[model samples]
Target: MLLRIFHVSAASLFWYTAWYDQNFINVPFPNKEYAQYALKGRVTFLTFWCLVLQTIYFTLSVLNDYIGTNADQSKHASLLRTIKDTLFVLAFPVALYVTSAFWGIYAVDKDLIFPDWLAKLVPSWVNHTMHTFILLFIALELVITYRRYPSRAVGYSIVILFNLMYTIWFHCIYYQTGVWVYPIYSVLNWPARVGLQLASTSTALGFYVLGEKLNDFVWTKVHNKMVKSN
Candidate 1:
């Protein structure tokens, strides 16, 4: 019951944040250059996309908890479980990667990932909500739930497919706007850009592995407690 309440509350929070971020319109930049990217169609951003993903994951999770399972793990549960598992496999690693990559770059050079002018416009809370709180929320989900991770081949394939699709999407955005989705890409040459892409994909894959290991370790402790109680 407590976990169910947490899922409902988290779903509401992510939904609110994602909606506010999408509809937010405050022109912090003086000129059209930054305004075009900052206040306009934001789906081009991986961070925003991840926020949307988290929103959907939590919403689905609430539904799954309420009606997805019974004493027998019924057919309804099986279907919802598959969908939840697929979304979790994608959402967990990608969310972690985006948060890690965002803060890592911000720590070294805010301009590269988030510029000063942009920062002035977006609220500090919104900034942390999107980048920082996401990590905490997802990590909490992992600690509270035991998800059966897909096999390495299946998981890696899904991760690679997502990265590849986003790679194409951002490149298309660049072709259209004459600007990279991230400023870091603007400064890198082709070889360096390729290397960065590979490194990022690898980092996300590592997070997937870490999540699986953590899940197993956490549930093992939970199982022990139940056995001891019995």
Candidate 2:
């Protein structure tokens, strides 16, 4: 019951945020040029993409839980479970990376990652919903669920592929539009950007390993407790 509620609420919140962001009309910015960029390019951001991924994950989770309640042994239920697990391979680490990286950079220099104009344009709750609540929800899910971690090779491959695809995507966007999706990119030279990309990807890989280890540690303790009790 708690799981169902959590999944439902999460799905609803993410959907709402996505819709809000897509349709948002910025208040007058002192810099009309940046306002135009923000309006057009906000959706292209990795944070928005990550939010979409998380929304899909929770929606699937809700469906999976519902089906399990109705027909726990059904083939459809099994398939949903499989899809959920596979999607989590991409979702968890990426969400964690976004939250951590955003704040880490934001702390050092808000202008780089999230500028003052962005703060005035986007409501605090919405910003936190995107960056802060996401981590909290995912962390709660991790505590409640016992996912079988994929082998290191398979898991790392998924994370690497996703990171690489996004790297290519932003570069392509910049090449075409002559605009960096995030403010930080504007300050980076090619070599610095390359270093940043490599570091970001490496950090994501580390988070994947962290998730696997944390999952194992949590469930192993649970298993041991059950064994002792029995």
Best by TM-score: 1
Error of 2 at 216 (Å): 0.7
Q: What lDDT, from 0 to 1, does candidate 2 have?
A: 0.78
User: Residue by residue across 110-192, what tens digits does model 2's lDDT show?
Assistant: 88777787788898888998998888888787888756666899999999999998889877767766777665789989899
Clash number by candidate, in order: 0, 0
Provide the clash count, candidate 1.
Answer: 0
All models: lDDT? 0.78, 0.78
Model 1 pairs in collision:
none
What C-alpha lDDT, on a 0 to 100 scale, does residue 74 get in candidate 2? 18
- Which ten residues in a row are the worst by lDDT in model 2? 68-77
